[model samples]
Target: MTSTGNIRPMNDKKYKHSVAVLISDGLGTFEFGIAVEVFGLTRPEFNFPWYKFMVVSTQAKAVNASGGVSIAANYSIEALSVCDTIIIPSWHSYSDKKDALLIQKLREAAERGVRFLSICSGVFLLAQAGLLDGKKATTHWKHLPKFRRAHPQIELDENALYIDQGNVICSAGSAAGIDACLHLVRKDFGSQIANQVARRLVAHPHRDGGQTQFIPNPVAKLERNAISNSIDWALANLSEQITIKEMAMQAHMSDRSFHRRFRDTTGVSPLHWLQQARIAKSKELLETTNYKMEHIAELSGYLTHETFRVAFKKRVGVSPSAYRARFRSD
Candidate 1:
């Protein structure tokens, strides 16, 4: 194995992973940095099979980063042929068009079952290559409207942090890329190695891609209003069986008014919000303790274990037991 400071040509067959991160002019530094951090770093001391990282330049010449900093992209688009995974961290904008050669290379790679990961506007590239056509994909929530307008044929999920369509995986902005990468690690390796990687990075090993993207506007307005007080009361009293009447009473509004205002302020009905809160509580219990389903259901304000399981599966995208098995530290 030959060593070069940070960049190297990993030719060893035993390494088991070959990853190519696409580089171009005006690349998002943070997103590219995440790829390097997750895959390019050397980790021989950990005694685990790691990735062979290549920053493949879309153009022949060196490129300028988002802030005009020069980056030496030593590998060419031909490097994509040797890679099993290709990541487009972030395109400069949604309007950035791909050349015919790059589009053809991506299409051929997808035909070979090479995993494609797109961060932020990078999904535009996969969309241009026709990899995400008729597939459920996501990007940064801020770009949701434009992406929808640009490609209405693709099933775009604005609420998701990411979407894994098997071969073509797309993630939202910045940190969500890390989540998606860790998920790949978990899929290729097991939870143990993925957890080890996450520990080194000091990040959560698994965040369900279905989790809603953080939208600040509605949450901020809700917090500034009286409804937040009632929300807090509901959180504190999650162990008890509660209903919309309690929520309306706490907010000092009529049931109809509370229903309308709650939906308006939080973008969800009071009943849905309460169910989410209960499911969240159950998740905490599942991850932290050895409580049985009955005890957890009761403590989390579910009238029955059956009700708890149904709601937990619907909201969290996993059963309580499965979530605990994957995430429980103990």
Candidate 2:
């Protein structure tokens, strides 16, 4: 997603909603751009009241980024006062020292009603300012050990894409920044507007802040490779009552070993994996054909309508009927 050497509001009368994006040395241009793309870009198509964004630095001058790139920061720390929302994109350990004045300004800004967000390593700066005390927040998973050791009082959420405790929003590593920024847009506007923007950006419209951030996750891919032939066989004959033992035999493993290995391979248990796949297949039938739920449940390998409903709700976040209502047949 980098191009040309990495080339990267409105006022709701109720909020006036000006956002101050605080930048410092070694900032991640990509993270800053994500904030700008959502907040600064003029999206007349969405016809929404957009936010005003300001790029403020610790000091008003050219600052050095990682890899020795220089960018100008025209605004000073004084801009914090008028901001309705404040975003801190990142902080890097430059010569192993953080700017003290920057932490003071973050403290001052938090004391006001300004909404706060820290993407990736920016949580370090926020935690240093003591704004995250007693609030559940997330950062890049790599920083969890050090962050907890530094601020044990702050509740750290490791599994989520992001976490929103009203005034404060913290995102997991890099991509979660988009999820958080889009979420702020969705919260201010509505699902229709958010979906429109997601279409423009070619990103998902709705990801709950609590969605899991998969780390490395070679286990799923490796297991899927081993179980590929079996999965294909199961898919072709889903109408048959396929037992776990049958699948274990196909993968050439004992039932007990298959149970442990499958759970380790996928984040979920074998039953949940089957249920997830079944729910996806049923949804396709629901949209393309006039199949009844009972029929779909049977065809999709779900044993009963009640079991399908429970599994569908648990995995898809909606009932089959509700999903079809929201989706188009075409």
Candidate 3:
């Protein structure tokens, strides 16, 4: 059972393609639930091959989850031998040492080119199995310091939503698992199938792995309403040239006070926020319209196309045209 000699490609004809999820005590149920939601459901409508799913427990008996819940495993570690894909939802605790047998099963799976994935803190198991050595991986941002201290050999990203290294995949915090699962569908099938799955799940169709996990949300309302109102006005008038003075005036405050308060509330300067808003608007235009570069620049509050290109590349890591080509729908 520990050997991967029986491992077969997903396209193998004799045995139904298998996906085994590794479960253990103290694991996050939400991360494990995502695997079941994404891969366990039957999709006869797609007219594609159906995967055989099994929950493989690391131990012999029922495993207890975070909330005093116990999962009766349908299979033991031996079940991993035949699986085309192995998923680890979340290893809830970094302090616990994984059993050697489970680690050996994973290592053998890796040797056979079997796809293995981890969501959130589940990455700790892969690192324990030595699968993430020298590979760039990511986990929940809060655990970054601990992950770095424990496994200095692995390259852990603090910002990415997910990272794929062929056979091994790692996803960021809790919700990011959806993006990673969709990415797997997209990679295994195609964009069309991925989009269909996303629609079925009522999730965003695509959010590339390179995108940031930390999006700066708007500040909560303050007692002083003028600043929020002015910010709203700025969003409405993104096409026009706006200045710090205009924003301050709209807030009925002097330049110095507005700057200080804006920073305190939003964690960014007003001008910086304005630039981000303009860039966001430009992305919307790029995805939904066929606007030319100059027109888009003008509409997004940039004075020149050259300035727009520089700013977009600096912030988004791609040119306007490239972004549109990748994200344009219909």
lDDT order, best first, reads: 3, 1, 2
- The best candidate by lDDT is 3
Question: Compared with the true structure, what per-residue lDDT tens digits does model 2 show for residues 38-68?
Answer: 7877767844346766778775567776666
Model 3 TM-score relative to the real fold: 0.65
- How many pairs of residues collide in model 3? 0
Off by over 4 Å in 3: 1-16, 219-330
Reference-based lDDT, each prediction: 0.80, 0.73, 0.81
Worst 10 residues of 1 by lDDT: 1-10
Q: What is the lDDT of residue 31 in candidate 1?
A: 89
Name the runs in model 2 displaced over 4 angstroms: 1-16, 93-101, 219-330
Error of 1 at 230 (Å): 17
Error of 1 at 286 (Å): 16
lDDT (Cα) of model 3: 0.81
Q: Give candidate 3's error at residue 297 in angstroms.
A: 22
Per-structure clash totals for the candidates: 0, 3, 0
